[model samples]
Target: MIKKFTLFLLLVLPISAFAQRFSQYFSSTMVESFENPAQGIFKPDTTKMMAFNFFVPNLSASAYTTGNATTTLKQYLFLHNSTFPNIYVGRNNFNTLSTNNNIYVGMFKMFADLAGKQEIGFSWQIRAEGTAHFTDETVQLFDGGTNFNNLQPYTNLFNDRYYAQGYHQFSFTYRETLSPKFSVGYKISALSGIAYDNTTINQSDIIFNKNQSDGTSALYLNLIGQHRTSYTPGSFAANNVVPNFKNPGLSVSFGVEQHNEDGVHIQYNIKDLGFIHWGSDPHIYNFNHTDTIGLSSGNAGQNVYNGASFITQQGGENKSFTTVTNGLAEISATKYFWLDGEKQFKYNPILVASKQLFYNGIAGAFINNVQYGKVTVGVMGTYDDLKQFNLGGKIMFKSANAEVFLGTEQLLTSYDMFRAHRGNLNYINSNANFTGAGIFFGFALKFGADVESPANASSIPMGEDEGFLKRTFKNIFGKKPKDYINSPGATSP
Candidate 1:
């Protein structure tokens, strides 16, 4: 039984495709000095500056099968239980659910000037970013069979499956100022690790057989097997499997900021220009090709072909496959202006154009301002390949010296054709419409005061007596002081 199951796993494993989507958070934002090379511009005033930021996002979707062909949901169910029956499944029906969550923490400090210029400041920044995803699926069989009779006499069969993935990254950035209004920065990052766990449970009495006479018979066996078995939860448990996953990559960026005499400030940056490859390589598996003939009760002697064949049965036949690498790139710019000279009231409306250099492109904008001294508001819009267009807004309040940003992104594009295809299936098909959208919310806070500017040098002072004596000696000589001094100090006069 173990060997048969192992063979089954090997056969179906290559059929599953895993594609990691680019993060919207990473896409919509501009590249910081840490990720770009043109970091030798704009300087932040850290003399009394402190900041904090946070982001949260959620996405949910479903779709009906296109035409009569098997959808991703159906394929998943069929792979797990080859004998399960298919029923009507639509956009409202959810055979699988996947959720992703992320959190980010950033902090920095600036001190000490380089090259004897107060305009040149150095700072150290650390960023801690984490991501977690949970996927739950429930597959149901439409076939009426006793093979799943353990749960019910002769009715519906269902299975519940769960999957989880998590990872974290810690990075450090160094920023240096080149001018009073411009600075450049670079960041070196190392990913500590990553992990993925998946679990599948057959709630019905369905059993999968390497050899089954018909579809109905296969479904019945799968149902019966599921009813007789119990699965334990945890990584690598008898019922759970964990895949080896890790991400290693380098990121470089450059940014520039300029403040005109009119107090109009603009900033631009490019970021995340790197790639991450999963450790797993691609391979093809051969399914058993033997056919089984009937061994009916009346027919005592009948040849049956179970379609069983060895991997080399077809004269070393092999299939080719390759794994896809995941990577991202982005460019963004923003403009800020003060509504008041005192800088108490500031209007920062920014336009951003960004693209995943390797995967996708997105463009958006945001407007932020302070009203009532403690409240802030922002509105944003973005276009995505899967969700066409998205519109959302956020409101924030400062309390206890902490600031929070609460807003949604891609709200309008969640139900488009793009979302239906990619979100439902792990694979990207050319025929699939790619306009899908997702939403996210983020927060940032400021802490500590900006550092003080360096002290200025004072002019040198001379004694009044020296000035008076020089004037008196010049008058007595009736000539220029230079001539008197050159004449041996007026001959001891």
Candidate 2:
């Protein structure tokens, strides 16, 4: 009777389900300068610049029974086969089904401008993330006999669980203007405070004793695990407890910006160039457990054991789990050109084009890392001489972003390619035909500063000294500066 009920649940339960993927959001204010670096390239009159941002993402997953009848039945039978008595084995046919959510908040500000040439900045960010999984299974059998003698076969099982994890980060950065045209900056980030929480409940039906009248039976089991690690709030020390590989990493970036007299701009930066260790040792969890037994008319139920154990077996057996230490790098270039000159009309339109390339590993993950390219085009225009608006689209040529990945899968079977190990798990190797496309929309507002700086400092007297200062600095710095004052025969003093 217990087996029959388990089968029924597997067949009748809703088969439509999906899996979630990682999603990231940057604070609108934190990203304000990302869109147009020119807007924030110079120190504002105010020494302090503060911004706040929030990000939220929703992910989900689901799987349904597949394969030949025998294969499916064999997989079904394995669930009832138990290697250890009292071991819990809830619904098993459904491969993957669950939803995960992640939220991130970041705050940043420029605290001080040293000697009006060097600026110091600081930022603090945190993330709250969690995942929940659900599954159900049931079996049914029928025996022939008179109404009073008839036997009702029963089988039912259900399990649900949730896992939660979080972390926090604090970073400091210093920017120094080596010359009027060239500058260098460095950032040191320290992260700490990691926590985890997990819970699970398993239910099944079984008969304790037979001989008397049939009686309904049920079993309930619950398991929970929680851990918290302490670390220095603003520094990484030997005693610090790292969170996950993805969460515990330090990064440094060196960037150069150059602007031509024609308003063309270019920038390059290498980020996540370092490694971080989350835990002193790897943690492994084994998920292979089963229960199997059959009831017959003339003998005790037959026992079937699969020798599969659930949860990682401790002692003598070691698993290697490490996070990526080498980080990726990015290079970007942009050009701005006038679309409409309104010296006569009072309003002007400008168009900007940018291209970016990202390689998973900078030092070298060449064969193992993934790389992609992207292009963006935008138009900026002033309306009524008081307001401005900008619109643009970015085309990517590589693996699809998380959003595109989940959306495309939603239109197909409930099974998630990554969860089922159906194909290459890496984004680069995933079924390319199915994953590759994302579109983003954005705009900006301007309130002050309208006088455009003369492209060539030749029009102003001090322009020559400024231009010479920038050129001489660039030569010494090995990188050109953006917006050099226009001047002929200008030489550094």
Candidate 3:
């Protein structure tokens, strides 16, 4: 039982993926309160408003293969349907295999204002995240069948790593305008961990030798490693899904924004900046088991044979350790262009770049958004270092007291799923690897302040120093001039 469980835990779970939706930039939905706190004050209304957002969930996953393999999700899934060779190993080099899955459910989120100038929000979320990485040598030993005996003597192989955690989050946010052009916002989160596990390898190797006399030969093995697991018993059961507070953590997200007279805005944000320290009572396993086993008949002048596997497992004393939260760093610029002389209709072009600091993933996107009256639409093109290329869009309707939106990062897959084709399942028949795909659908109900008019809303009041400097510059120049740097309007199309 222990051996089976160890193998499952070490080899099954994989890495993580980013769950953020790029369409949020154009939706103008209340969920932006969580995505970018500074947005809390951007609407034109001054009256206090309240809103609840639901079903805004995002999922991300990816598979790792040989350097020359098909890395895209669609291509990999197609390949999986047909003929595929055994694991590919680089010549005298280590081949890597990795996988990650991460999901976020908004559960329930709402935002309200302490006053017209200040916004406050709260949310409850559930998350499942994990990652697994291994090397070719490890794969050959376990999956190669008879190939295990062919390992070169004294060859060094290092290839075993994994981490997984599950938890629930409660968050609170506050945002306020420092000046009309400047605003700052931040969120504080408390996490209740449900489960956790990780493993680190120290040393592993195999040695082969043959006896000179009529006897059975033996192979020598040495393995060393440590692992940790923690969970409140029964916490994962369907009927007892609540995690205990015995293992809790805290984190913070903070950001600032500045926009000028034209529709141009610049913003910077750092999110999920914290860590979780597993409780002192977590379980620990240290492996140091090794043995020599004989193979072949002893009647031969010399026989070579051995079969010994299974790492020793033992309970460990209570010790606490920390795991960093999935943090992110982001910077973006957005410019709006008016489509009509009335300024009631406009389009915005946005460019954003972001990084998952903890997972070492980078992503960027370009989005074009058009809003006229109560309807807004957006299209986006996105890519990430993880080999994901996505084209998606969003459509939304807003009223004085409500908003609804539907969007997908995998629009093509969603369309295929709805058509006569087998949807993404088509790739499953091939020898392809399905990396990741998801859809986002959610709605918001609002109460208070009338819906602000996007075209007629007044801009933030200028800071005293800013106004004085601008006036002075205009006087010296004989006429007010364009602010190429801090101006609000577009620098280009």
lDDT of 2 by residue, 133-186 (tens): 333221111111111122233233334444434345455655555444444455
Provide the lowest-lDDT 10-residue window in model 3.
299-308
Off by over 4 Å in 1: 1-100, 105-166, 196-249, 258-266, 275-327, 337-345, 366-372, 398-402, 410-450, 455-493
State the lDDT of candidate 3 residue by residue for 348-439, as single tens digits.
Answer: 89888899887777889888889898788888888878576777777877765567776666666445434413545544333433233456
- Quote the positional error of residue 77 for candidate 1 in Å: 16
Model 2 misses residue 423 by how many Å? 29
TM-score of each: 0.45, 0.37, 0.69
All models: lDDT?
A: 0.33, 0.30, 0.57
Highest TM-score: which candidate? 3
Which candidate do you rate higher for lDDT, 1 or 3?
A: 3
Write the number of the candidate with greater lDDT, choosing between 1 and 2. 1
Q: How well does candidate 3 score on lDDT at residue 378?
A: 82
Error of 1 at 472 (Å): 55
